[model samples]
Target chain A: MTIDDGPASDRVRLRRGANNGVYERQAVLDVLDAGLIAHVGVATDDGPIVIPMAYGRSDDSLYLHGSVANAALRAADGTDVCVTVTVIDGLIIGRSPFHNSMQYRSVVVRGRARRLQDDAERVDALRRVSNHVVATWDQARPPTADELRRTMVIAVPLLEMSAKVRTGGPVDEPEDLDGRHWGGSVPITSTFGDAVPSPDLRPGVGVPSSVAALDGTAVHGLTTRP
Target chain B: MTIDDGPASDRVRLRRGANNGVYERQAVLDVLDAGLIAHVGVATDDGPIVIPMAYGRSDDSLYLHGSVANAALRAADGTDVCVTVTVIDGLIIGRSPFHNSMQYRSVVVRGRARRLQDDAERVDALRRVSNHVVATWDQARPPTADELRRTMVIAVPLLEMSAKVRTGGPVDEPEDLDGRHWGGSVPITSTFGDAVPSPDLRPGVGVPSSVAALDGTAVHGLTTRP
Candidate 1:
């Protein structure tokens, strides 16, 4: 396997199955936008740790916030970190177990993380993060100044990134394509159930459009549109 | 946030919302068994990198594959690595943006990785990895000696691991629970579609049992049971 360049970037090191490398910026963005959580890798004195963190995407940045895992980000500030998000599509079952694979879309973003200290940017990023998960900014109470301080928001530019996608039927070895074994892809699907309302909801409160309009692709980013 | 002991080891570094920590070994094992892919973190000369790879869970070990991404794993051989797998349940919506989060179950296993060299173990691990994704070993053509030799497999002990879980309704601030904002959990659903037969599938080969049974929760592991 040799290194194949993607998007003329220094960070992308795709090899082996270079055909799976996706170079389109829009394609990479689509995966990032649809993904719910990103696995963040940051190095520390203890060793390298990869953490699953919920992220919000802007046009050029990814806001990662999961207050509980803030320690990893805190250490990642000004240091290179790898953020990977993947959407599994299905299982690729070939004529042989050796040829079986998975259909997935993955994006790896690498860059130095910057901690957000400014209140306005922090609030905006937080709002995007909130809406990214399930839009609740408009009706929900806004974050107080104290809450903002308590929360930690880290931003990573989406400039250095790469995308890989696997689709279609399995690629079987010539000798094994005898048609005796069953081969095809079994699609993995996620069906959203009805919303479970809070026990002490206000009398007139109804499900928000964001909660109502989850099409399984992802939560619509329109509600928080500027 | 403070460090709490989970199953007695020097690893678990959980902080902030310590109640989220689930210290039981069985709970950790359950997450590993259910997950299909894991984001593996390995420290390389380039820096810390996280690669999402398909993994199969054996009692005390995990076999990581995704042959294309084997480069990262090869560099991690005999080195400390962190493996993190996550299963997202729903979006935890609070009355305020600051309190919003996602309901998830995640396990973090940390330890050195050893590349499997023995053919017997390699074939065994590969079969487990295949079954873990979708059971297809029974009817599918078996891997040849050459194919097995061409493949790469690595194993990591399930030691120094931690599990974190977030469930239930949002933890709303007393002041903001006025029922003004609609808040609850929107479950994320995955539904598997019918098997898409390969373009050149053998006419009489019916779908395998593994392909027939996909419950969204996961592909059942009974077929691969010894």
Candidate 2:
């Protein structure tokens, strides 16, 4: 498939299924912001490593949060890294097994991740990360000074990024559509169950609004509200 | 954080959050089977790239399937690669944002992927992959010979692997527990939605038992049954 449109970077080019590739910056950012987890790829002496880590997006960069001692976090420093976030929407069951596929939206960002050395920047990054997971950042207790010192936050600029999405029902060949086989799509959604309050919570402290608002909401498509 | 009993390979060691790392083989396999998609890491000349791909597991290896033109599949051949599968179970909302975390089970496998050159092996791999996606592969139309030829399958052995998991309520400091903030865990579950029948399906062809069985089932936890 031809390079329809997107960042003209070699690293972000889609070599296969070009029709599903999305090059728009806003689209890529939307996928990044919607996802709370990213699998970060870092090259190491042993080989390449992919680790699942919590992340947040701000402006043109993605912030990855972890402990300073995390292997993947340490390996990503000064080296080119890939951060990929995927949200599976459904399973497309076609008439034939060959045509069966998944409905998903995935974003891949490649850049050098620089460690946030400034404590203020690092704390801000952590807040972003927290907000991404739970929309109630201000209501939740902020990290203490010592806690900020212990966490490692890496900022990867969204210089080269792409979003690939697959949706709708299975695309079966005309001949197979007439065959005696059923085909369809099963939607898969991420939902939150009942909130189990902490056993040691004080008697008067009730479930905060920020935490209660998460019920029945989509995990990735959390509302961007106050 | 001690290196609790697990494969002691240097590549599989947990460098951080040692308390959350699990070293058992069965535990790792459970997480692998419970995940429909994996973020695969491959080293390239430009840097490291991670891409989301569909995968199936056999006795001792993981099979990755994609079109022949997929770049990440081509790059993983004969090179060390990392495949990570993660299932988010819940959100650990701590009293402090710093302590907030996700309850997830993740498996990381590091090994060199070998391209399946043998047609028999390739077809078997494809069958396994299909079955992994839909348990009723026997009822669905099998892949034609040409279709089989156009697909690429890579086999990465389960050599150096580790599973990291976080479970239960948030662990807040004693002082924070008394603070006027609610803290707990919001369970996250991946559930399947209704199956929308294909518009072009023949009038006589109704939803098959295989397709109807998918309702209410977890996407990754589908039983390996007919």
Candidate 3:
């Protein structure tokens, strides 16, 4: 299949809790955009292993960079992979510990992840990933030819994916709701603190606009839930 | 293996970047204790998949609670599993886009995960899982007998595990250091927002002490780096 048009279409059907499945592609895209990392899974001879990696999403493709967990992508090497991103919305305290739950928005994308070989494609994918995290790829110094050649990036078609969300508050049994147990939700928030300048930064290099925009604002999906 | 001692001693060998491996058991334990969730990987008939799970660690075993992603644990019944947790500490802006990296600590625990059958073990494991997220299990209403019976829980021995850490700042090319590129790290933080009471909560119910501890202090590994 061509890189632009993948064979992925409707491969994800939740084994259970079917009602929580989100069919809208936009919902999947929203979670992908808000997440900082993707938990990448690949089958190996030994067993299935999951590793966290920084990733960026194109229209219908996910570009996974060869970063800290570079070994995970290199090992996948054009094999079936599942890329999942989870943004926890809040904690639901229920009348019973058994009813305690987390309000979260999660997406699972299943497809064969092919390592991009073309330098041009690799550069584009790398830029997407870099920009997705902090949105300064345009202003930052671009990757050199040698760097591009050395980087190992992979692309996963986003066509076969579904999102599962647990929103609102705890679902407690009627008898326990008004009892002694506290029944409510505690919200969780992730935010970028004030950008700290590098000790060795040039005398007058100001913080880039993209980094400047991260002044205690909320990270989507991970922050502020109703 | 007994519940107290897992067969996991050393199953993790970094496929690459061996220097970053932290072999200390305490290092692995510290990362696990500080983290809020585990990205669990399991092989399915279709392919390998990774799922985000809320997990807890006793002295040697990890207790995984069946929450939103219960399907994954059920599929992994009595199978080898890889549970990984990554806590991002900071974003490193480098002299070149290629050098951009994240400062973080992560642990990968691999073992045969078995679903717990004993009621006593299940109760203990579930309590550990609850307390790990927000240490209020003692105060929260305990699970009912039926709740215990219906809950699906799995235990992964922390015997075979390793911790990979990347701390400190960006490591730019020697020549690129003095160039125009900004080289520093933007620290990322995760904290519990104010406890938001559920709409129908009784007016006399005040925030619990365990949750009150969440007033803006840093989450261990996800916040602040030197």
Top of the candidates by TM-score = 2
Chain B TM-score of candidate 3 stands at: 0.90
In candidate 3 chain A, where is summed lDDT lowest over 10 consecutive residues?
Answer: A1-10
- i-RMS of candidate 2: 1.4
Q: Which regions of candidate 1 are displaced past 4 Å?
A: A1-5, A215-226, B1-5, B66-69, B215-226
Ranking by DockQ: 2, 1, 3
Q: Score the docking of each candidate (DockQ).
A: 0.70, 0.79, 0.57
Q: What C-alpha lDDT do the candidate models reach, one value each?
A: 0.78, 0.82, 0.77
**lDDT comparing candidate 2 with the true structure:** 0.82
Report the lDDT tens digits of candidate 2 across residue range B55-165.
Answer: 888878899988887888898899999999998888888888878888888889999899999999988887777777567577787778888888899999987899888
lDDT of 3 by residue, B1-226 (tens): 0122332453477655566777677767888887777899999887888877788878879988774346678888889999999888778777688878787788888889899988889888888888777877877788888787778889998888887788666777788766776777777777777778877777788778877777676666332111
State how far residue A3 of model 3 sits from its true place (Å): 28
* CA lDDT, candidate 3, residue A4: 25
- Pitting candidate 1 against candidate 3, the one with the higher DockQ is 1
Clashing pairs in 1: A189-B190, A189-B191, A190-B189, A190-B190, A190-B191, A191-B189, A191-B190, A202-B179, B1-B16
